[model samples]
Target chain A: MTKNKNNILSTENLAIGYAQKKQQKVIASGINFAIKKGTLNAVIGKNGIGKSTLLRTLSKVQKPLEGTLFINKKNSNAYQHLELAKTISLVLTERVPESQLTVFELIALGRQPYTNWIDSLSKKDLQKIQWAITATNLETLQNNRCSELSDGQMQRVLIARALSQDTEIIVLDEPTAHLDMHQTITIFELLKQLTKTTKKTIIISTHEINLATKMCDELIVLSENKIYTGTTAALIQQNAFENLFASKIVKFDRALQQFVIHSQTF
Target chain B: MKQKPYLKHFILLSVLLFIFFLLNISQGSVSIPFKDIFTTLIGNTDVKDSWQTIVLDFRLPKAITAIFVGSGLSICGLLMQTLFRNPLAGPFVLGISSGASLGVALLILGSSVFGGFFLTNSISNWSLAIAASLGAFLVLFAVIMAANQLRNTMSILIVGLMFGSLTGAVIAVLAYFSEATQIQQYLFWSFGSLGNLSWSEMRVFGSIYLVGMFACLSVIKPLNSLLLGENYAKSLGINIKKSRIIVLVITSLLTGVITAFSGPIAFIGLAVPHLAKMLFTTSNHKILIPASAIIGGMVLLICDSIAQLPTSEFTIPINAITSLFGAPIVIWLLLRKKKITI
Candidate 1:
C-alpha cells in the first residue's frame, strides 16, 4: 500500500458502481491509487471505458459499491457535505446556465462554501476571486457574459472557478473536451502550471492520450476491468499501454510514441 | 475584479417599491386624501371610522396581500428557474398554482363528499390551505421523481407544463358540474384577487411565507453550486438529492400559500424574476432572490391599484391587470434578442 502523510487522496480496493433502488452495477473493481499534493494526473481511456466513471467516483460525485476512499487519510464518507465542499472542488463537463452570468460571477460561485446564506463576498473572497481570474488570464472576460464566450474561453472560466474554490484537490471531467487543438494544448500547459504554482492535486479525464502522455506528470490508464498508473516514462517501460487497444487490429509503438495498427494480410 | 454594483441596484429597487406603495395607496375607488393615507400609514390618524374602514379594512389588507403574494410568487419563480435551469420556468409552469386551484375547487364543490369530516365554514379556509399545499406538494414530488430519471431541464419543464394543463382541466370539469353560485365563486377565485384576504388570513399567509423564505435561504450555497450543474455541485460536497428536496419543499410552500390565500395570480411569477435579473445583471440567487421579491411586490402593487379603479361599474380582475403589465415585457424580451435560449 502506498501511504504518504501528504497524500491528498488514496483509494483502496475500490469498486465503483451506480446505485439504483434494488441493484448496483459495478463499473470497475480493485482500483488502487494515491494522489499526492502538487501533482497533475490525467485519466485516459477509450470512449465508454469508464474513465469518467472512475474520476467521478474518486471525486465523490457518486457512491462506490465497495471499498473506501480516504481524503487526507480520513474516510471520504465521513466528511460533512459542507466540509467536503471546503476540501475538494470539481469542474463538470456540462453547459449549466441560461442566466446572463459574467465570467466573474460564475467564478464567484466557487466561493459558495465560504459565503453566507445570502452568498456575500468578503474582502478576502474578492482577493481570491481576482487571483483566480488573473491566474486563468480571464481579466478581460470578467465582464463578458458566459453565453457570449467561446467554448475555449468558457473552459478557462470553469478552471478559474475551481481555482477560486481554493481546495486542496480539484477533479475535472474532460476539461478540454470541446476545445480546439491549440486550446487543448494550452489547457494542458495551464494544468502543469497550476500543479507547480498552487501545489494542489489536479486530476482530469481526457481522450487525448498522446497529449496527456506528454504533458501530465502521471497517467491513469483504464482498460478492460483494471487500472494502470505511474509516471509517463515508467508506464511506457512497463508496456501498460500495449493492451489498451483491440488485440486484433492495433499495437502501441513505444519508440515512435504513437499507436499503429498492423494489417492482417499475412 | 470589482463585483457588480449590487448594492446600488438593491437600493434603487427599494426606492421603487416605496414609490409604488404610495401609488398603490393613492388610486382606490374612493380617493382618500394623500395626507390622511400617509398619516394612517405612519400611525398618527384620527380619521373618521368610515374612512378608516375604507383604508384599513378594505384597502390595507388588499394592498398587503398584493405585496405578500407578489413576494412569494417571485421568489418561487426564481427558485424554479434555477432549479430547472430554464428561465421560462414559473410557478404555474410547474403546475403548483393550478394544483392549488384544483384543491380550492374540490373544497368548494366536494363539501358533500367530506360532509362527515367535522367541517365548517371557518375551517374551510384552513382546509383549503392544506389542500392547496398538498396539491403543490404532489406536483413538486412528481417533478422531483422525474428529475432523478431525466437530467434535461427542457424535458422537466415540459413535464411541469403538462401537469399544469392536466390540473387546469380537472378544475374546469369540477366547475362545470357545480351549482351556479359555487361556479361563480370558483370563477372569481380563478381570476385572482388580493381583496379576498382578511387580516386574520394575512397572518397565516405571512407566517407561511416567512418559513418558506427561511427554507429558501438555507439552501443558498447549494443553489449557487447548482448554477454550475449537478455533477460539479456534487463534487463541491453538496448532497444534490437533499438540496433538490429542500428547494422543492420551499417552492411548494411559497406557491401553495400564495395561491391558497390570493388565488393563482399569474404573470408576476413568470415576469418579475426576469425584471430583477435584467436590473441587477447577475444570476447569483443571493441578490436575485431578494431583488425579484422587491420588484415583484412593486409590480403587483401597481397592478392591484389599477385593478381597484372604478372603470365603469366593475373592477377588473387582478390577473388581467397583471397580464397587462407582465406580458408586454416578455414580448419585448422575445423580440429583442435570440441569444439567451431560456
Candidate 2:
C-alpha cells in the first residue's frame, strides 16, 4: 500500500544462479547496486559476461545464490507473485506471435494480472491498453497483426505489452537485439522517451555500449568477473567503462566516441 | 456497440443444428414422416411401442450422440492447441484416443482373461469406460513425462507423435490375434458411429463432458497467460506445473470419453480449434475455448449428417467424411503458413 522512496530495486552482496542447483555458486557475487525509480539505466557488457543472468536475477525470474534483493526497502520475497508482476514487468527478446493477434489484443495481455478467470478486459483496462499503444507510437498498428509488423515495430509492441502491465519497474533483456542500425536507434530513443514520459524505472541490457553510453542516464558495466555501476560520465571519469571489452583487438577510443578495432597493423 | 462476427456464425450454426436434428429424426431407415417426428418429440404417436422404439432407440440417441461427440472432440482439440501452443496439436496427437481404443479393444478381446465374472457382468459398460480412461491417461502420463524431459516444443511434439504411433502399433498387434468376431466388432466401432448409444449410455458422456467443460472454464485465466510462455505465466502468479497438469487431465478426459463412445473421430479436434482462432483473432482463451466448443459441435453434427448420406439408405463411415474436409485444410495450412509456436 505504501511506496518506498528512491530505490526500486537494490541488490546487496547478491549471488545469482539457477534454482535447481543446490549450492549457491555466484554468477557474479558481492554485487551491490540500486536502480532508482524513474531512471533510465543501461546495463552493458561483453557477450557471455552474465548480463542476462544478472538481469534475470534482479527481475526475480531466477533466485540469487546469496545476499538479498529488496524492493522499497522490503525483501522482494515478501511480495506475492501477482504483486511482483504488478510491480515489475519483464520483456524478453523472445519472438512475438506469428498468428494474427492485433496490437490491441496483444497489448491487452498486459492486463492479465488484473483479469479474472474469464480473462475479461474492463473499460479501464482497455483505456490503459490504448494508452500504452499510443505511448509506444503503435496507434496505426493497433489493428494490424503482430506478424505483419517489421522487427522494430514488433519490438515496440512487446514494450507496449510491458507498459500495459502498468508496472513501476520495467526490465527488458536486450530489447534491441534484433534490429538494424536505424531500427536500433528508433527503439533506444523510444526507450529513453518512455522512461521520462511514464516515469518508470527502465533497466535494459545491450551490447551497443557506444550508443548506450551517450543515451543512458546511468550505466551498469559487467566485466572480468566483476560488476560496476555509475552514471555514464562518472564511469568514464573513473576509467572503468573502457575495460568492458578486450583491449588487444578493439579499444574504446573516447576521442572518437566509439570502439576502434586495430587497423594500423593490417 | 461492437459485435463479434463469430456471434452471427454461432447463431447460424445453432439454426443449422436444429435443422439437422429435424432431418435426423425424420430421415432414418424407418422413415418417419416429419409430422410424426414432431408428434413423437411431443410425447404423442399414441404411445405406440414400435414408434417409441424408433424415436428413443434409433434417432434421438444417435442425434444427441453426434452433438456430444462433435462438441467434446472439438473442445479437447481446442484445449490441446492452446496447451501445446501448436495449431497441429489434437486429441490424438498425444495418443490419448489410441489409448482409449486400446483399452476398449482389450476389454472386447482380452475380457476372457478376466474370467466369467467379466463375461457375464452387467457392469461391462463401466468397465469399458474405466479401461479406456486408463489407457488414455497412460498416454497422457507418457506425454507429460516426455515434456518434462524435453523442454522444446518441437521435441515434445515429435515425442507425442511417436507415442501415438507406438499406441497404434500396439492396437494393430492386438487386432491381429483377436478372434474374427471380436475383430469384426472392433472394426465396426473403429469406423465410428453415434447410432450405438442409447439414452442411458448418454448419462456418462454428459457427466464427463460437464466436468471437463467446468475444469476448462476454471483455467481460462492461466491458459491466457500460458499463451505468452511458461515463464511468463509463472511470473503472472500462475503455477505452470499445476495448470499444465489440470489441462492435461481435462483434455485426456474429454478425448478419452469421446473415443470410448464414438471411436476416434478425427479432424474435429485438430481443425475446429484453428477455425475458432481464425474467426476470433484474439488469443484470449475466454473467447477461443467456448467458441471452439460450439463451432466444433456444429462441424461434427454436419459431418455426422454427411456420414448418414450414403444415398440415405446406408451410412458411410464417419472417418471417411472427416478426412474429406480435414486433410485439405491441413494441407492448406501447411502450404500457406508456418506453424504457430508460443
Candidate 3:
C-alpha cells in the first residue's frame, strides 16, 4: 500500500486527438491525472469517447495534441523509443498474426529489449520468461501453438508476455472487450493481483464500468467531453457515473453498485 | 530444450543437403561414378579427362548455383512473408523478378526492334545480367518509394502486384514483335537456366547471397518480434520502419541477383519457407531462416537433378521443373492448413 504514494504516470493540461496538416481534432483537453505505483487503474467511457486516443497519446504510440505527459517523473517524450519500451509494455486488442510460434517462443519475445542482436535469451532472461509463464498459469500451454489457444488463454498469454517484459508499467487496450462475464472478471482479477503482487502499475481502457467500479483502485471516466479522475469511492461520491450516459433508458444504481434499466409500464 | 529440436532439424537438413549435393554432381548427363566424381573434385588425375571437365567445370558451378539460388530465394521468401505477415508472400511477390525479366526482355527484344542485324548474336550475356539487375533495381526502388508513402503493408503488396502486371504487359508487347530466334532466346532465359553460370558469375552470386544471408541473420530478433504484429513489435522496441526497409533491401538483393542469374526460377521461394515451417513447426525466424535455406537448397537440387533427365542429353528447364515439384506442395499445404493466417 505504501507504493501507492509514488506516482508512476502523470499528465498535465494534456490535449488528446488527431492532427491533419492544417486542421486538428481535439477529443479531450486540460486533462490532469496521476497514476500511482502498484495500482490498477481503469479508464471507462461510452463508445466513440476518446479513451483509446488518450491511451495511445500516453503510451507515445501516437503523439499528444498538446500538453505534457510524464512517466517516472520524466517527460514521456524525453525517453528514447527503446528506453520507453523498457519502462512500459502494452497489450493491444489486435489478434496476433498466426505464426508457427509456440506460447514459450511468443513469451520469450518479451525479452527482446534485453536480448542480444540475434535474440538469444540469457539465463536471467529465460528465468524471467519462465516466471511469467508460471505466474500466468501457462506452464501446460507453453508448448502449444498460439493459433491453438482460445480467446481467454490468448489474452492471458499476452499478459504473460507483458510480465516477461519486466517493465515498471503495463498498458492494455480493451483487455476484456471480447470476453464473457466470467472471463472478464478473471482478467480484471488477474490485473488486480498483478498490480499488487508485482508492484507494477496497470492501466486499461474498458467498457465494463460496473466491473471497474467494483475492482479498480482508481477510475478515469471519459464522459461529457471531459476527463474525471479519482478513486472509485470519491468518483461515486462526486456522482461521476450519473453523467456517463444519457440517463434516459439505463441509470446507475448506487446502492447495488450497478446499472439498471428503467421498467416501462405498458 | 528449444535448441534441441532446432538442432536436430538442422542436422537432418544438412545431411539431406549433402546427399542432394552429391546427387546433383554425379547424376548429370554422363552419370559419373561417385568415386570418379570425388577423385575429380579433389584434383586427382585418375578420372577420365571428360569426366573431370564435366564434374569440376560443369557440375560444380551448377550445383553451387543451385545451392545459392535456393538458399537466397528461400530466405528472401521468409523475410517477405514475415515483413508482410502474409503467407502468400515470396521473394518475387514484390515484382522483383518481373522487373528483372522486363529488363532482360527489353535488352533482348528491344535490340531486334531498333536494329534488325543486332539479332546476329552480338549482345553478350553480361549485358543481359546488367539489364536484369537494373530492371529489378528500378522496380525495387519504386516499391520502396511506395512503401514509404503507404503505412499499410497490404497497400505495398498491391502496388507491387500492379508493378509486376505492368512489367508483364510490357514484356508481352516486346515479345510480340520480336524475331523468332530473339523470342526463343528470351523464352529460354525466362525458362531459367541454373547451369549456364561461369565461375565468375557464380563468385558474384555467392558473395551477394552471403551478404544477404548475413543481413538476414542480423534481423532475427526484429523478425521474431514482428510475428505478433507490427504495432506489438514497435511496442517491443523494434523500429518497424527500419526493420521493414532492411527486410526489403535484403529481399531485393537476393531475389534480384538470383533472377539475374537464374531467370526467375519459380515456386522455391514461395514453397520452401512453408516446407521449413511445417517441418520445424515453429515460426521462430532464428530457426526458420537457416532451415529454409537448407531445405531450399535441397529442394532445388532435387528439382535440378530431375530436370537433368540423366538418361537423355536434353535437360528440362529448371523453372518448369521447380513449378512441377513446388506448386503441388504449396497447394497441398494451403489445403491442409485451411486458414492462411501465417
Compared with the real two-chain complex, what DockQ does model 2 have?
Answer: 0.46
By DockQ rank, best first, the candidates go 3, 1, 2
Candidate 3 stretches with Cα past 4 Å from truth are A1-5, A263-266, B1-4, B116-120, B333-341
**Candidate 3 clashing pairs, residues 3+ apart or interchain:** none
Residue ranges of candidate 2 with Cα displaced over 4 Å:
A1-5, A19-26, A256-258, A264-266, B1-5, B45-48, B111-126, B141-166, B310-313, B329-342
lDDT winner between candidates 1 and 2? 1
DockQ of 1: 0.49
Top lDDT model: 3
True contacts kept of each: 0.63, 0.38, 0.66
For model 3, residues B253-310, the per-residue Cα lDDT tens digits are 9999999988889899888998888877778787888999999999999999999897
DockQ of each: 0.49, 0.46, 0.64
User: Arrange candidates by lDDT, highest first: which order?
Assistant: 3, 1, 2
Q: In model 3 chain B, where is the ten-residue run with the lowest total lDDT?
A: B116-125
Best-fitting candidate, scored by TM-score: 3
- lDDT string for model 1 (A46-135, tens) is 888888888788877778899999999999989888888888888777776566677888898888778776678899999999999999
* Cand. 1 Cα-lDDT: 0.80
Q: How many times do residue backbones clash in model 1?
A: 0
Candidate 3 iRMSD in angstroms:
1.8
Clashes of each: 0, 1, 0
The candidate with the higher TM-score, 1 or 3, is 3
How well is each residue in B1-342 modelled by candidate 2, as lDDT tens digits?
012456676677678778877776666666666777788888775756787788877788888877788777877777777777777788778788878877777777664444453453343556766777878878888888877776455676677788878878877787777678777766776787777675677888888888988888888888777777766676666766677778777888888888877777877788877777766655667677777777777777777777777236788888878889777875787578655432
